[model samples]
Target: MSAVTELSIVLQHDIDEQYQYQPGEIIRGTIYVTLAKPTAIREITVKVYSEGNVSWKGPDEQVYQAQEVYVDSSKAIVDTTYDIEPLQLPQGRHDFPMDYILPENVPSSYIGKYGNVTYTMKATVVGANSRDTAISSEPFLVLRRQHIPVLAQQPLSMTASRRMLCSCSFGKLDIRVTLDRGGGVPGEDVFLQAELKNQSGHTVTAMQASLIMTTVFRAQSRSTEFRQVVSKKRDEMDVSRGEGRRWTHVRLPLPPYVPESKLEFCDIIELDYVFQFRVEMTGGSEVRLEAPFWVGAQPQGLEVPNNEQAGRRIHKGWTVRGSQALLFPDGGPGDGENGAGDSGGQQPHVEHDYDEGWGITLVPELRNASEVVTNPLYQHQQNHVTKGARDIPEELLENTKL
Candidate 1:
């Protein structure tokens, strides 16, 4: 007698393989199962859940992990037994449709090096025998609704002044920074306008602007923060007393991989960003100004390019090789093709040469060597520079001197 040998499951969604959705949207799909022969089963069940996983290694070689289940649900489609003579029948294929509506306040799905937010659906078949259970699962993506507050849509501007007395001589420096808008999304450019007036006796050496990201993680009563410079632009200037320098339209391109601010879905983690403008003065305290902003997901119908296209647009020196092109990590283009170039009509392979040094390099090592260094005086004044959703602190504003 022939018995059930193989079983399989397939998930189908209205959006095909994209599997992306916004909050409060209905996720509708169908599950198909194939059986090789007649089978007896107890019940077929399906489950949907959201999960967050955090894992990292400490400096002392210790491993740490924090995981949580945000949402979970299960349903049974076939809960009756098929052991009866009339109810039992030969099976070749079966199909079941399912649907679920995502909650309104769920956090956006994300994948990172140390943590991730994932949503998944699983289907299980429990046979009459305890050991004959079969199961399968599939993952989908969810994007949080990013809305810019009314006040954040207005222009952002800030100014600061610092005076230094050295060797019985005093000088005053004034700096101002402004942005076209206070909020932006990935794949967009932020226009920075800055003014520097060196009224002090000291000469201005240089000026710099940067976009920074600060991420905070809270795990079991312990909280830690990390800072990363996402993008930066600098200009060298020599300004004596009463000389002023102005930057009209300095552009800072935001990369598409940047996540939105305030990941509210994940309660244990938070994120923030800022734009800093600094004027270096010779033999005197530096003038520093900051403008806080938001980086959020692009609204629907905005039509921002994907990661590959965004990379090419931001980095003029980027050379993306074709799928059939030969690539060597340390070798030049003259190296012969290694016979792996033939992708057989699939998506072409692309590579970026960060050594050219035209745009923002996400690699930490490369950025450290290429990006302008933060002035030592400014670094010593503050252990970390961060701007969050709340108002700027009075202490932070008062400590603008470097």
Candidate 2:
């Protein structure tokens, strides 16, 4: 009785891993259609869609929301037949080939509590009768293949110290975190060396290492924040006053589901991560330190183990230098993919104090993103956001970049 019984969109090369598409890669699939009888079809169409949106309420109950769309394309693959007759698709199974090239600027898929960024594909068939229309959609992931520097792939560490006065006795506690490398892709393990020192009268009850993700939502000059501990390992050990403990080369495997650092291409939402080393002390007090690193969608080669180097105490004059993710404006730590490091006769030396424990992306003075040779890694920002050579802000520009 019905013209179409089933309609579905299926990928051709999903033979394996999660169906992931890089910007330059091809997305080949097939649209499977099953018709109950001969159907007069007006047209068959395929569409691609990508979007990011954020919604949350401020303290005053004012709802703040914003959305950005990166891709929305449609094509008609089948149309009317000759002699003004609609094309007839015979009963049984029919296959329509699908092919598409993802754009280079597409961001990765991220599902958050208050915000979500996603990419999807849909195919539709229109029959002579409106009731015979059949449609199908499939969601996929997009990760801009990014690269970090060879230098940034090396080991990195950070320290946090706090002085406590318990029972009128001056005491101190110090904690440090070290990782085999500063960055890696999903499914890889991040080797860690954590140290804890307790000169205070309080007892060390527990020590924990956690991978935390922070998601920030910005809209209309307002923003909200959310933090979740994705992975963590806790060690229960007690060492009384005037003692120190250390663990070497403890493996903390990164979860494959987490998003990449900076989450470029989407403007309304920003996500970052931190590796936290925390110690729970007596009297319900806690001392913690965090080291930041980049996690990407593509994997890098594993370097030599740094077990010996990871345990070394962080000494004076060993100030934590900011990762290249801060100095280079266009990409990741190396960020070579975006063509950021090219310079003039002199590579500028800019000395400024910044947070080393956060994956900070520096601004390269974007006057207009629509202009040629723009910062593809950071074009999602507003112009006035950065202080330029002439002290001109982005808000003053005629055609502000997005």
Candidate 3:
């Protein structure tokens, strides 16, 4: 196909906010395109693509990396493609409307976010003969949410457990651990609680507990990368009369993901959240069990491993090559009235310590030692926020240290 002399695309509105609806809600939008010169094209195809990049060190001390980009080929949202009638000359603007119901099986929890749970709306226009496919990227914000039936949304609360029912030949012990809000957004905080009981007719002397994030799969398939050290703390306790124990409450700060990290899209986003507790009694009794939980992320269809060959995917719009992190408005209004405080209050900050051995660095010329790179991915001369943090550039790996 011949290249059109000129190409332009426009959106109906600057920001299109679609309040949250059930998984089957229809997502609709319109796009207008104009061509400067006449061009022959077979049909126009619309598609959406999402991208995410994560950098960390593996056990080998080599930097482990993963990246994913996809064009919702499933057209899971809208399937029909529009035929572009050949235009002879003076092609003004044409309106393209989209209307389709989200798949019923599509979990509402996976609706938002480009990769995991965030919502992304994109419209692509494919030229019949030309290799060019014009695209307009739209980010959808779900403000108001509908009340899904309590039963229909019950799955959101159901958790994946790995605990084995205790059936010791000598005696039996009962133990249960649960983590609330098993799922959360990238930057949101996670609260975990553990409840333990000694029903083996013995007094437990002492116990230990820990919280961990396990990778079910990854692009590299390296066992060493599957485990990420989250938060760990131990406590001593005494129990009697089928007594129960609750450990000091602990919070798991969701590590800041390079805006693109998603749960549903890639096969590797699977996380088996574990809450483990161990106990020992005077009767020479011992038992251990792991309570498995789930953490949901923005849905991404699948992931593209970071490699040179994968660059051929997105032939259109520039990749810019950078990492981006976004912060939700705390979902809280500052002051009363307009929700703006007269004076700036303290900014919520999360401390992320990056131990050197965690990821391998490609460039030896970069920083020397391992360090904890704080969020808002920007260089920090001092501790204060000098400039607003922006997305990390994808091209420059040297500066992309975690």
Candidate 4:
């Protein structure tokens, strides 16, 4: 029979606030335990760690899984090494202070469809039976710092030309689009310039621009991808055969909670961003061009809010500078008032997380690699169909092959 009544782990001294921390920062916390009567304890341990995992099924119903460990460590609070067989405690209440130094290369916290990256602090208490034990765990948020100026060094430009013989068979319609820079932080403005020379017999009806985000999931056998348009704008204008148009200083504001580009740390999943311009001409002729860009930046403390800025710190936000927030609906705000109903009523459903890792300690002895946990918000159960990947360029697109 176990006499222990309660066991809990309370995180204290949040670096920025509410268990939010950054790279190379020290994390300080406490562990609390309450007992019903006098009891003899075998040992007590506390562990803090971060990890990334992916699990999915292939076409033939074969499951594929992969995992990577970021930061994993454990400390022993009470041990009965030299004293004797039975180390007894009078038993009422006791507390143990926790101290851990976070690694400099840790990525942000994230939960996506097929994978997740998580940070946890867990404490365990054991007795003679080892079958019955108490465990408590708490999750924290991490925000990664980004360097935008480097990735946005040069402008990204693209052009697509097409000829039509509908009205009278004139010349090729040239459509070109350019951005002042190819990268930006969230909540910042990106400038755009465009030129349209419509010599084609058919008139130009409308033009559109979109900010696209692509996610790629890779395994040993095959790879899959998910592409989406996070933001878009349309301009309805008319142009005759002899007339042309030029647009300058067109502003495309980047949403503050948009996902960052190029998730460098995550092995199973990779992210990339691009800007697409489409021009629809009369007689069913259209020209489309694409320009790749980046989103990896953390704003200054003055620019961020007080309660929401976990340290301004975004890590599970880190892999790409709050990049994972783009995948989960509840992580950040949408175009609407709250976190949902942004553009149309077609907003995607968001799965919530509660007691992400809720269970008794499976192992009492600690050499310490704490435990393996899957975030409740993951989309591992869904069926995925593999598709052919389009050739994505690493630099500015110069051809109409896409």
Candidate 1 off by > 4 Å: 1-20, 36-42, 54-67, 81-95, 111-114, 127-133, 162-174, 196-208, 231-246, 255-259, 278-288, 296-402
> Could you tell me which 10 consecutive residues in candidate 4 have the lowest summed lDDT?
358-367
Clashing pairs in 2: 383-394, 384-393, 384-394
Quantify all predictions' global Cα lDDT against the true fold. Answer: 0.61, 0.68, 0.39, 0.62
TM-score of each: 0.57, 0.71, 0.33, 0.59
Most accurate candidate by TM-score: 2
**1 versus 2: better TM-score goes to:** 2
Q: How much is 222 displaced in model 3, in angstroms?
A: 14
> Which 10 residues in a row give candidate 3 its minimum summed lDDT?
393-402
State the lDDT of candidate 2 residue by residue for 238-274, as single tens digits. Answer: 7677777777667777776677888888888898888
What TM-score does candidate 2 get on C-alpha atoms?
Answer: 0.71
lDDT for 381 in candidate 1 is: 33
Q: Which rank order by TM-score, best down to worst?
A: 2, 4, 1, 3
What is the lDDT, from 0 to 100, of the residue 265 in candidate 1? 77
lDDT (10s digit) by residue, model 1, range 1-402: 223344344443433443355555445566666566666667777777898877767777676678778768676666766455222436676776555556656777766656778888888877666665678787877766576566766788988878867558887777888888887766567777777777777878888888888777666565567777888887776888877887776787776556678887787667788888877777655666776778766443333223332232122211222234333342323235422233332333345434432122232121122333221112223446566645422211111123
- The true-structure Cα RMSD of candidate 2 reads 19.8
lDDT of 2 at 61: 95
Best by lDDT: 2
Write the number of the candidate with greater TM-score, choosing between 2 and 3.
Answer: 2
Of candidates 2 and 1, the better by lDDT:
2
